[model samples]
Target: MGSKRRSLAAKPNKEPKLSRTDAPAGLSPLDWQRGLRRQFGREQAFGLENLGSEPFFSEFRVSNPVSKSSYRVAIRGRGPGGNFCSCPDYATSELGTCKHIEFTIGRLEKKRGAKTAFARGYQPAFSELYLRNDGKRRLHFRAGTDCPAELREAAAGLFDLEQDGLLPEERFGELERFMAVASKSGHEFRAYDDALDFVAGRRDADRRAALLGQVFPSGAADPKLLAVLKAPLYPYQAEGALFAVKAGRALIGDDMGLGKTIQAIAATEILARHFGVSKVLVVCPTSLKYQWQSEIMRFTGRHDENAVRVINGGRAQRQKDYALTDFCKITNYEKLKPDLDLIAAWAPDLVIVDEAQRVKNWNTIAARALKRVDSPYAIVLTGTPLENKLEELISIVQFVDQHRLGPTWKLLHEHQVKDEAGRVTGYTGLEKIGQTLAPVMVRRRKSEVLRQLPSRTDQNLLVPMTEMQSLHHQENADAVAKIVQRWRKTRFLSDKDQRRLTCALQNMRMSCNSTYLLDQESDHGVKADELAALFEDLFADSEAKAVVFSQWTRTHDIIIRRLDKLGLGYVSFHGGIPSDKRPALVERFRDDPGCRVFLSTDAGSTGLNLQHASTLVNMDLPWNPAILEQRIARIHRMG
Candidate 1:
């Protein structure tokens, strides 16, 4: 056996010779060029990596210009047609390579001082672009008497050559617009090299930091608040607070569930500690005034009444609350509308607007009132600032950077798309909009920062409806279907038909929660029994705290009856509860461990945080998913 093996090893395996063709064929040069153009269009051809000589092997990591995510490719070839790439484009090709191979060749050509295709005989209209610093930064065009119309259109947002002598540097976004337009219109742009570099540097994170330093000097944190803190904040929260502090006045558009409250409080504390900001006014929805006060106390560890005040009650009482200027004050937007003058008189150093989208209509009393309130710096906090239209964003942005965004019509003309008839069609220039807002907007979604957040269990609990409830649902749905079918056929729906359809759906949903909602005399709901069972199971674990939400106050009433029958101590929060008393109710439910259930309606619990409770149950789903998310967020915030 050993002799046979030796003989076989010695003999060449000449049955067939496997050549490089047995391996998959590579992409052709033309194919590689096409791929290169595709990558260039995506702005992914900018990265060059692992460039080595001798036995050359090149690796490149390209990024999505918009998403900022990267993809890598490796090349192993001498040059041109001989190069092969590890990317799928090359590997799967029978006679060619990938964009990486072409990019590598281009880089090699550039290294050899050979003028690339773009450089050969390309002459720009402008000979130079100069940035002048004379109290204000300005970009000056030179040697361009016959500038292209596209360049003029792209730079329209900057400054008109006829109206203003120089383009403002703060409108650095115009530089990007110019580059894009230049690339598309075949207008050369290397002449604007210095101006482009200057604008690019302004967009860097360091630039934001420098701006922040100018607004809030370094070492501006309050020692008293810092000393009393129970635990350190998460890195993102700390960074957010620092960003807010640096910007002085800005928008914290962090997606919901990212702890905007703590960030706002931290900044407020810093302003109070370092800038002699004795009066920090917080304007939020009526439901969130208490939540803001709670966060301030919890984060600052100031258990005293004077630590934070919720401005509420009679005019006389509110006057007294305003008189106590040594502490941070929280008030709802509506309340401030009537007393803007009084609040403005106090001259708060910082004004924080929670759920800032409430003032998205600049003409509204809330927005006007917010503008009237005197504050050196302001923080507008919201998850959805641009809810429906770009104009809405302009409204909120007006509070922080009115000079940057300018007038609403001006902003629309710069960004909005128009048709041949000059009617607004859609929006353009979004990239420029981002650049303008970059200086003052800090946004991070939960996906970006919640690596350490406790795993959330999302369960759709299917509660079986009773026979009567199911029958009612089917009838109501059928009725709506008929009305919709008629409108679909005729393309018109009368007011009576529309109202009837809406009422049918409303009654059906009410029936799902409890038949008692549809008929006050009736007294049964499958959800009530489900809630009772859920309560029993939760209370069995003794430590369980639950926040229950229903869309209807009547449904809450039914749940209240069920809980009372079961001898469960609970607190109910709904529209019936006075605005002033809501805070005490929340406190009672949170502190009293024996209070296993806190009942609330969507409208009642809109902005309150009840995270002390570990569990949340929705008795019935709302029409808008955001309302459900809002309900769950009350209990699902960072510790």
Candidate 2:
């Protein structure tokens, strides 16, 4: 018999580690010190008082000549260990050194040129480097190796050098030309274009602020439309609308419960009235289609006949609606593919895509379909634009303003950190990305506008598992482990095994809800009893209402049974119900005072108005934290 051979998968390639000497190799301490002196003059380094120390250790209060930020520097034993600065540059660099360290070493050593430090054949070239928003809301520049004193003085004269940074933006042609001519000997312009872009954006923001004051003195574009709005917009909402108008094509990335919908509505009115944009297309989650319709009517005071049309019905009806060109149209992302050609033909002046993260993956059919449609202005709305990687942000940005960010390749290179072998290690230059996004994105947090929002408190309640629940959970876990073992032995799992595995996990989760779910026995789980008792107490005291969220309909079913047993008036929403009936359910839950509880799965979480219910209960938690936020938002949005 032939011997059995074990198959193994290939291991991933390892990235090369950087050496301590690689950055300043072939150059001595003197060369590095000279480079430092050229970048930040001798006076700034020695201007501070040196706090006395022992032979091995010393301290100094080094002040940043540009930013005027003071930092303490300490030197340890010798070489690399002795070179330490409190500044971020020293701590973050792979070389374990900074200009501060070089300056200190230059002072410590008495005979600067006693050793053969400066190489005879060494040559120097000038390169201009610009760092954007280095957490100081200021731009920093580096004039590069052996750069002339004339250009350095010119930069300091043109722009106020804050500690070691630049704050002013004006004519830099002379500086740019000098750097270009000097760098022709072979050096790079480090983030020079990005710096220029940020300067122009700042100027635009100033102009935009002035224009918005003139346009919306009383808040919204037209006071009559503002009068029609269901509730007055908070001050921040007005600011966001004005920002969107200035951006033309933008992304509203405000956190959930900050009223992105109302802000988008206000911006839409501005586009129509100011820019002569008559046709508007709104693409949103299927659940939110009617919600958008309701918001438009409430805010615009435009009835269904004349103002907003939600594209629905069968293919023929959808075609008819798509053909109509005058009014604002609302549709879901899923419907875009089926009626892509007609929607494109409709030729919307502005397109607003809600829950915009749905298009994060560019390879999806929906994303590709949305891209094909031609719209002069587009605004995407999402609380979490980047769910995982930087690529997701790029995808959303590409949809909003494709040219402003330049090529995807260039953006990725600027932000993504890579190791020696070209593997992505991590990310950097976040502040730079923030600067680029400043002009085209509006972000607000609930914490910043705390006065406008109600205070919230969170409590965690734990219920012990019942004996029956424990037994079922353990049994299913063992069965799942055995199945996994079999799959390992076979090196593959069939569709049947996959289904079996899924069902096994589902059984375990259901067991958590109630062992009765799996066994159909007379006895119930402790969680159900706890849930029953809590609602019983809440009802006994006051007229309280809650929106309870769960991941499974089976859980919802068990809760419904308990609520029924408690004689509590309750409503339910889940995937099993027809989509057309959901609106009625939401309305009943919202308006019906006697409806004490709304039982729902994940489907009830998005774009629903249940703010009348002050409390939220999660019977079972979803895997993603974002889903929990969405569920809470249903009861937490502005009136």
How high is the CA lDDT of each candidate model? 0.67, 0.68
- The estimated TM-scores of all candidates read 0.43, 0.44
* Superposition error at 170 for model 2 (Å): 8.9
Model 2 misses residue 560 by how many Å? 15
Tell me the tens digit of each residue's lDDT in model 1 across 281-312. 88876645666766677778877767788887
Best by TM-score: 2
Off by more than 4 A, model 1: 1-229, 420-423, 457-639
